[model samples]
Target: MNKLPYIFSLVVLLSTSFGPSSAQAQERRGWSPQAKGAVIGAGSGAVLGAVINKRNRAVGGVVGGVAGGAVGYGVGKHIDNKQKERARIAAANRAAAARNAEYRRSLARRNARQTVAPTRLQPAAMPGNSLVAGSAAMAYDAQGNPVPYASNAAYLPNDAYGDASHPYSTSEYRRKSW
Candidate 1:
């Protein structure tokens, strides 16, 4: 009977086409959490619905699948949002740390450049071989304390009034004037 062979072929085709495959068992690496949740929810809900409804299994499966898929997707989306927020906070903290480190290094370099070696200044080493009776240098030490260098020499007149070309002609520094 030709019908028998055709019937057998049809049965075989249906079974093979609808049966579970190895590809379905494997996890899809590219699927997002929400997509995975939706698929899993729909599949589980359909199975449960079919089992619970004996009379209209098709309608029950469809209804259950849609409801379950919506809930699963909502839960998965919430998880995704939380993960994103945590990642953002961590990135901000790391960026702040990097900036602070750079600031400290900049400060260290600036301090190193501004460092000065200690120099002993004496009245005899001054330009006029003496400091004014009560005047002091405007310089400070490392800790910002005043350093006083005193002498018994008489006070000199303002040096701003002197002429460069007539250093020896000024009354303050004329010949034999010390």
Candidate 2:
């Protein structure tokens, strides 16, 4: 059984060596611009022989050189095309990242603006500013001192509804109402 396997391997090697198909040749040999140029040169040399000279060596050489030059140019063009595509993709990626960063920055700014209160936009109101000052002419006693009256009270009593220690409520000042 081992001898049979060895025989099979030898047969495969021989088949590969003698293979007529270009695909097989391509697999065995790597594809390159230099190799393609050599093949084109050989083919052009054979085709141009009869027309240029009966002996044809000079014409064949010239034709082969031209074909090789063309093949080399084509290889160079293929390489340049690949490089251009890669450059375009890199530029597009950069543009997309810039746009995304700008969007995030704007969103962050908007969110910060929303979080802060607009305290400076409106005027502050005070609790006692609206109350009229009492006239001393109406309330003066015989000694010329102003008489104390119940109307002079700044606020009505809240009774026992609020905390005993915190007798004044801030809500009345905030709204500026007695």
Candidate 3:
């Protein structure tokens, strides 16, 4: 009859101790090493304690559990840390690879640009009778066709009307009205 109470107490203690860990394991997406280690430790400790101390099962179980738990925690923590470090290194390598690929693509684009012939400005197609200063005053369309100036007066070197920098020019006087 005394052994019945002792057995019940042992069961209750074990259940209470493992309840939170079991609940956490279920909630997690995957089994963590720490949790696995703890469960294994606790179970092995209980079994070993029972075998070793047949007369005082509770004291033996408690002491064995504490020692096992500590060792398990240390081993599990070391493994978890190593895994995290490896993952970090892998991520860094991937990022470096992506950067190198981008750099290679940019280098290829630059090389392609260098290899192509540069587009030259085409001469203006002036009428045979018309006079132009030079190719310096000429502009072109996308199709390499000459674009005529809006007014020949604007291109006249000494024309008073084209001299915007002159003190009495219309541009300077007109802005006074604003």
Candidate 4:
């Protein structure tokens, strides 16, 4: 009364994969949760059924294995659904984070354009070096910074080179006192 072969055959029938019938691989690679659960359930049920049913052990094993496999499949399906849902949420969060980072970068660029202005360098130079205000006042380029005014114009303090009616100017304004 060796029921080993019968029990093995019954297990094979209840399992998700019986044998490789197709050439292309399956989409969900490896043993799915359902397949794993069913195999585990069938093996455990067969042993339990045989132990419990003193007589007609073979029939008991077959019936118990089928019932156990069905239950295991259901549980595995639930788990699979949860995993898929979690993956979807994670993808959404990643997309939102990327969008946020892009927005921040755009804001920083806009602010830089509005708040920072091209700096004015040392005053422009005059001939005869009458005013060495910052140099003859031979002005230097704004080292990588932008220059706002014309380079040739002499920008002197006290209107020394320009309008003579300035508050601090004397008629000797253009004269080189130094």
Report the number of the highest-TM-score candidate: 3
Cα lDDT of model 3 by residue, 52-103, tens digit = 8889887788778777777777777888999999999999999999999999
Of 3 and 4, the candidate ahead on TM-score is 3
Whichever of 1 and 2 has more TM-score, that candidate is 1
Per-candidate TM equals 0.50, 0.35, 0.52, 0.51
lDDT of 3 at 109: 92
Candidate 2 residue-wise lDDT, 65-176, digit = tens? 5665666557656766787899999999999999999999999999988654322222223235335454312244444554433334454434434554654643332122
**Candidate 1 residue-wise lDDT, 51-131, digit = tens:** 888898877888888888887888778888998999999999999999999999999999989967675443333445553
lDDT of each: 0.70, 0.57, 0.67, 0.66
Q: lDDT tens digits, residues 20-70, model 4?
A: 557456564687888888888887887788778889887788788888788
User: Candidate 2, clashing residue pairs?
Assistant: none
Residue 120 of model 3 has an lDDT of 51
Candidate scoring better on TM-score of 2 and 4: 4
Ranking of candidates on TM-score, top first: 3, 4, 1, 2
lDDT (Cα) of model 2: 0.57
Candidate 1 regions with alpha-carbon error over 4 angstroms: 1-29, 116-178
Clashes of 2: 0
Q: Please give the clash total of every predicted structure, in order.
A: 0, 0, 0, 0
Model 4 poorest 10 in a row by lDDT: 147-156
RMSD of each: 17.2, 22.6, 15.9, 16.7
